[model samples]
Target: MTDSGERNTMTRRTVIGAGIGAGIGGAAALTAAGFEPAPAFAGGSGKTVRLTVMGTTDLHGNVFNWDYFKNAEYDDSAHNDIGLAKISTLVSAVRDRIAADRHAPRPLMLDAGDTIQGTPLAYYYAKIEPITGGHTHPMAAAMNRIGYDAAALGNHEFNYGLDILRKFQRQLRFPLLGANAQDWTTGLPAFPPYVLKRVHVPGEKPITVGILGLTNPGIAIWDKANVENKLKFGGIVELARQWVPKVRAAGADLVIASVHSGMDLSSSYGDALPYPENASVLMAETVPGIDAVLVGHAHLEIPERLVTNKTSGEQVVLSEPLKWGMRLSLFDLDLQKVRGQWKVVARHSQVLNANTVDADRDVVALLQKDHDKVVQYVNSKIGTCTEAMSAATAPWEDTAALDFVNFVQADAVSKALAGTPQASLPVLAIAAPFNRDAAIPAGDVSVRDVAGLYVFDNTLLAVTMTGTQVKEYLEFSAQYFKQISGTGPFPSDQVTNAPTSTAPNGTPDYNYDIVGGLTKPLTYKIDIAKAPGARITDLAYGGTPVAADQQFVVAVNNHRQSGGGNFPHIKTAPVVYNRQVEIRQLMIDYVTTTGTVDPKTFHTTDWSLTSNGTPITVTT
Candidate 1:
């Protein structure tokens, strides 16, 4: 977090004046030319001042309204449109509305992190045509055009290493804030913790708005490969407690937190880390002086939530826009001048639909060339498939498509550990159903086809675990299915994606992984009739019962290896190999070099669900 180079260039906060007499008094002159002043405040003005703060989070490098994997305009079952272009239009509308109102202060725009890594556009700049050499990142260009006030750092920002992230930060017009991201060596904040902006009032003191940024602590595990010895993360609540009072003491009348954590208090890493993965609600409940929070990273669309702080007895509002720029969060605060100072009297929050507006022409035009280049890159031919494979049935059935993923991962790991000390151990790989609609059609294939199958930007790692630990992992995965007895045939929806403690709505598809063997298929049956942890039956490798002490090298993604999904034993297990190889790129390379994806070479029906020993057939 302590990058001396960045500290030299970026201003942590704009310290205008601690009191009304410093800058806004004695004269009637504006703060600067071309800056219009708000309504004048007198000794007893008794005016209600309105201020609007707009926010977007988890943008994930999207600029245009397009999906690179689908090679088409982005659309889902909800008919939601994504990317900054749509958000730009929505923001403009909000700003124009505020500008037309004479009682409103200047509208503020902000983002809650996860900006520089998601789509092919983000990937292209990070890896292929890196922005490290001063080439403008599409996200920075588009966000700069949109004019953000500040943005919190997301865990994914470190995926491509600090070099790329530093360059991306330098390209942005606003400060990229991360109060919890600290220096590993010094244990001090590496990024600016907060920024204070002045909201001018014509005759009275300007409203000092303090914006604090906080990121998830899971970065210590998820991005361990990139940040191991360089940066460490502190809990959001702890950091907020230490910083909020300082912001208030610095003369902030209103404080807003742009937090890159979810409103939910769940942790994918479970008790592996002291801090929870999603702790915005906890922070709100624990921290004082925060009027509102812009939440992110959970990817859940929350319109508005009010949590009472423990000490202050004040209500703090929180709102999160859905991921990929699907929505915009808006907060309205009404301030009234007291005896001698302006104080916030009322506040309300809601989300504006980005799908309601067309993509802003200005934002699209600014990054259209970058978007087109990514489209071309993903559409380029890679190889051919002998037969089509789909992941639609992957959640209910052991589809060949997932097997192909496991094969590539295990094969790559096997080769990397060939001459190493762990070469003697067998290799197994785990894959999740990331995108249900992903498919690889027969005939010639493109990079998009393979990339679609593995949508996450996860890198590969190999960890050593016992056969017993593998079964424990599979048992945890089997919890994705609901317990049901005597089923001749059941609808896929009746069993899969069941609600769990960590995921109250339901376990995400990405949490249920399929473990496959390299030299031999790792076979197992998930007996849904049994209770959660006791569900796995007849677990074996190469048709033989896996012994309790059998040690094997498991090929896993960095997310899982670094404690994502709360899988058992992997986080504490000994790492056998880690080259920081991206799994998606590895699959693409496999297809490009082999020229053909013949599932017959790797696919096998290795796992299924059963009801009291009878194979349960699932109808999709």
Candidate 2:
């Protein structure tokens, strides 16, 4: 490999010919094969230039084969074949191709975070057997084997406390870069904001690739308690503005934003309006020095390279590999020097499916070892269920599995609070239907099923809220559903019309749905901006009118209890009871303790909407 300063002198023709020959099997054939060869422009005279970037995001602990929870073998038609083993194969193949082309640019492999905490393995690690000498995170182990260049922290990284997060960073083989995350008290970066590396391209000058990482500011709202003491996450755009120039000053010729955010362009107002789903696009447009963006979270698959600035129209590539190790994103970029500056002349992005490629043996072996250990730890049968508890349907409506989960959670909270001074107070439990659309079918309960039911391992918390607070909370939760125009099946428009918003400008009212334990014939309309205490109406607890001073015990996940999900009354509610119990454990305990659970017990007592002066027939 030549030194960085000597790179410009390299002969472009020799490099191009050699690269074409090795990568395409024929220099003349590839040109004839319709491959758009890089153009020899301005200062890029005889310099050979080739660079390849491979990325994956939102892996969600799918290091092994698909449906591991179901124990089903790989089947293409069933969407069954996706794993790190397969991803490793593609990585090796790309590396070999780059090697064969003596003139191609060096390759870099990266992950956009959200790697280890979404699957059964993560659940077992966090809730069952904690790794890292009780600090080690299994996701770090999995990522180490995959050989990431650098990783940007996703919001889920903060799901656990600072200790666990720090351990994960310490355990990683590569640096965790996040420009926006800072120590809450000092307002200084908690980790390095970016990393600059010299990549040696065969037959050309070493290219300085500057990689900057940023995550969504949503961490404050989603993980308030866990991150409250340790760190404060800043806005992505502000951080980008602050760091883009610094990265350039640090001698980075090409800047890539490894953002744990997303991009969306569907707006009534042209690209100027902020697209909640596609924050990456806005970041790219606002940050002048950024050349490309690799995004995650929101688990989307957007392969196209978008151009936001129509005037200069510089290309800004945005990509997110399909979650669960289902796909790999490859960014093939052609870099050329123009007046002492490098510009991306052309680029292409593609998703690699496991079924389409063979697995890399080395990567496979590494992941298999971890996979085996996790399987052994979670394989033991805890108990059996007479009826299959499933959450297969959307959680908003009644499903056997969700109903059972709410019932178990509520019962556990009530029992835990029963010995307190306020034990006899009416107890209300709230749970978000995470397994919407029955991802776990109604059947025998297994460790995998349990993991899927409550993947986050949130603790159970009980607080005291008044009848008025209870009614408002239910209305907020009801916002998850839209008033369908005639209910003709699931309306496509319902998604945009969702009653609740998770955006920065969203309404302040809490939207958590309350399950059972309430005897009020409460009625209320949703007024998003009404004062917290004023939205609820005709509220009563048990058979009596709720006294403004009378407090009622409410069961909620630790997230809500600590104001993580934006529930208003929860943050102020006195903790009647707090259990260091995992949501999954509560479900399992409920099943084992009761021997059998029925769906009828999980009925909703908190939601009702008025339409045309009369209550509309609500199903959930």
Candidate 3:
């Protein structure tokens, strides 16, 4: 729990604040509620049963403590330790402590979804190895090895289509729970809504804990092609409202919600809509009878926190473990038999860092075959780069790194649209630098280098947009910088292009799109002096003033075209060309077939910044 903050306890009367818990042992340490810390069994004699629940979420198919991107040991230099292998060792040590206490119940482990689709290993199995041909998913094998009890469905679960997801479900020993992912035809839960577990605590009576799984409603938007009309998802709060009472009525002593959503207190897309991506905070605040909530999808590590139920004013403990096996959320509930009923008297929640332990030998042995194959596959030489390319300057200025992707995308889509009616229109490509660590490293350009640069499962989409729409899209990307007024060609750091590091800062580099296909510069002076949308001016296309109705084909990713980032008119942009082949592969093919990548040939120099009337110097 000390990872982000100290462990917090939720009580009936009031939730105590910070200074009181960290041992200040004075009048200054008195809580806002003016209550001193007291032991659970301070009043009368009662049997105390302590059960620890551990959770992992957004693991995203990391099984080893090795960075598949770098082809090296996963270290602190990258600011990440992403793998279930290390988590396995950490879990074993914690379980050993529980085993020493004969009276303690078997500790329960849970996952909140996004178990697949991040690394080369997961991509190898899902796309290359073909687990659909009847092999156990590597993630499934690892989770089963670690002994997970249940997991929720995340929006990314539908990324590979339902059959593969169903195959994963078949391979898992534990149930895949999704209360809101329903059968549209039957209007019933397609997957098990919740799983009930009764744990025997040595001499005390068994306690039944119900786990409810809720997925993000964004599935319908993000994966509309795969899930359209087949499966419908409801909001987590609405679904929990219906199912929490049902689980309690089913003789459950406690209810724990495993929500695959972030803590967006205010629902995006307005109050009337069902928010899928983030609604964990609203769910925990509104839903009653829930003891602790395990949340994910935001990839934030909150050691421990307390939220008050808006309607009933009941305090609920909520914790989010950062994504990719970096941390584990632990909820330890102290339940005592009060009046013949097992009820929670005190609860504590904290996220444990997975870096504390070495990679589990069992996990390493289990995945060694696939690991070795992926290492060789990524290490295989694809082509060569004439000069090194780095995404280091992508945010501050349009660099060759992002230009490389834009050129490949525009060229591929232009070829794909050869026979189509939209082929005559000029094709403009929009791309972003997703990985700041991505670099060409000089000589050979391997699969890992290109894959590391793109670092997403996004495919290509060629959408028809007018010149006006193009400007709006650029304006959206322009929001990455803060509005400025002074004409002093200020420090580049003064601009608000905050990169996503340990936490989300400013506009994430992945979401910041730069435009291509113009003889004119894609960059322009932001007269921070003007309004946000109105700031973009002097827009030209091909040595001429851009007309409002001027039309062109724009290459984009499916995520953005599906309203992922709320780019202006992007979701509504008509698709002229679409392909399922990943853009990362296209980058590799572009380089492999084209011989060598030269910065002088493809690097975009078509961008500059100006403040007021004077030219400005911005860091690249």
Candidate 4:
């Protein structure tokens, strides 16, 4: 890797042959049987170069197939594996195959961001043994060993602020690209917008592939406190339009966009900004020079998608590997020299499942100590609980588990607002049943127990809203339930996980919010018999009917406060307090400082669902 600050370039010595492998590992040999280069035309000259680009995104700090929150091996309903350890094995196998063939170009390893935040390992480095204190982040240590050529900046990369992010960037072996992340003062690209790589093919001129990176524009709203005036995020499509042309003019033979946005053309912020949050498809459809795109940020697994450019009339390939290193995206492009220049003639992409490969031994050995430290950290007992509290019923019924989260959040916000002008306003807190399996054991409570309650890396904030707005917020959240005709006993699955335009598959667990009050209980019923906008009924605070004009200070997470779920009025609501404290750490701190997990002090049966005022019975 050569770094000139203006142009970062790398040369690939080993080029793959025409025939690419169809397997996850290198066992399947590459032969010339399947692929045949185009015949030489009248003026066509030179050889066919086969180049491969492998990508991973939203890696969220998983280096092993282990869940620190569960204190066990990672296992979900899908039975999918995760972490860079598994990804390294697949990368090594592919590289080994390329080397043995002697005709394949050395594969380029790239990531599409979200590398620094997620899991207890990420949290320990960010807050406990802070990388800012000169300690190397576990992610930097492991990824450096993996030897990534370049990586795009993800929105979560800024969760810990610029200081930690810069430190992590300085420790890396390659440049971190962010084209749309501009300096507010200069309105220019803050990080290296793109990187150039010259693939050296024997007996032919080197093939130059330019990689451009773009981040989510919603960062301007999602992380307003951390980057309000310091940085400005631009739309992905516009940024691609501006930078892809520059990359082409730089003499790149092929242009690949490593974008940290989803293929869906949608925004969670709902017109709060000019740009949509996930616009990879829109960018591909509008941008002409792009040859391929590695998509991220939505955490969905899209093996391959082809979007045709409107202006160029060229088909562009796009792929997204599942998040948390569950899969790897591979792009194989065969280029032929035409008119004295290398031009891509044929290209295709596919995803390899990470579960099929074992964790790379070297990667596991490199970070064994770091992994052990996090395991110890999460397993340490912080407090004791008199009775177990589970979130299993939180989705359909008011459970003490979710109440515990609201209790801790509201208490903190209320204390922070004390002596301030907002002290007179009632403090309410919002929480979601992120994990139905999250539970506080009866006898002892560990960090992982509380961490399981809130899986996302969200921070706490205090926003001001009127009683009318609060009702509107609840009404919007009530849309998570499907409309039922009668109040007879019904299966929980039948009543929940309704589909919306924003969420085609069904509403995610994070989108359904539960609001609770601090000093007094905030009670309301979700009327499933009514339509979405009018679902909230019996809205009251402290047993008094909530007045539409009554003002309240609500404790909320960064995601919801920043318009993540498109909940009404929260993003536009005035922020009364913004401490930028992670909610997971806050709960851990509360338990450690208090030395007891008594739900009696925090839990309140404040909310329920009903059918026209008759309580709706739900069976789990």
Error of 1 at 176 (Å): 0.6
What TM-score would every model get versus the actual structure?
Answer: 0.74, 0.64, 0.72, 0.77
Number of the top TM-score candidate: 4
Lowest summed lDDT across 10 adjacent residues in model 2 is found at 13-22
Residue 174 of model 2 has an lDDT of: 91
Candidate 4 per-residue lDDT, tens place, 1-620, comes to: 00111121111211111121233346431121112222423333556667888899999888877777756567678778788877787787768866876776788988998899877789889877899999888888888899899999998898788999999999999889999999999999999999999888776778888999999887776666678789999999999999998998998999999999999887655676899989999999999999989999988999789889999988899999989998888887778888888887767888877766556667777787788777777887878988899999899998889998998899988887778899999999999999998888898888988888888778888889999999999988988999886886999988998998898898987899999998899998888999888889889999999999999999999888878999999998887776556798889988889898888887777888888889989998
Over all chains combined, what TM-score does candidate 3 have? 0.72
Indicate the residue-level lDDT of 44 in model 2. 46
The candidate with the higher TM-score, 1 or 3, is 1
What's the residue-level lDDT of 124 in candidate 1? 85
What's the residue-level lDDT of 85 in candidate 4? Answer: 78
User: What lDDT tens digits, residue by residue, belong to model 2 across residues 119-188?
Assistant: 5566556656665455445467656776778989887777666666777788888989899899989999
Candidate 2 lDDT (Cα, 0 to 1): 0.61
Ranking by lDDT: 4, 1, 3, 2
**lDDT score, candidate 4:** 0.83
Off by over 4 Å in 4: 1-25, 28-46, 383-399, 409-438, 441-444, 454-514, 524-538, 547-586, 589-601, 605-620
TM-score of 2: 0.64
Q: What pairs collide in candidate 4? A: 14-104, 14-105, 14-106, 15-103, 15-104, 15-105, 16-104, 16-105
- Shift in Å, residue 221, candidate 1: 0.9
Q: Score candidate 3 by lDDT.
A: 0.75
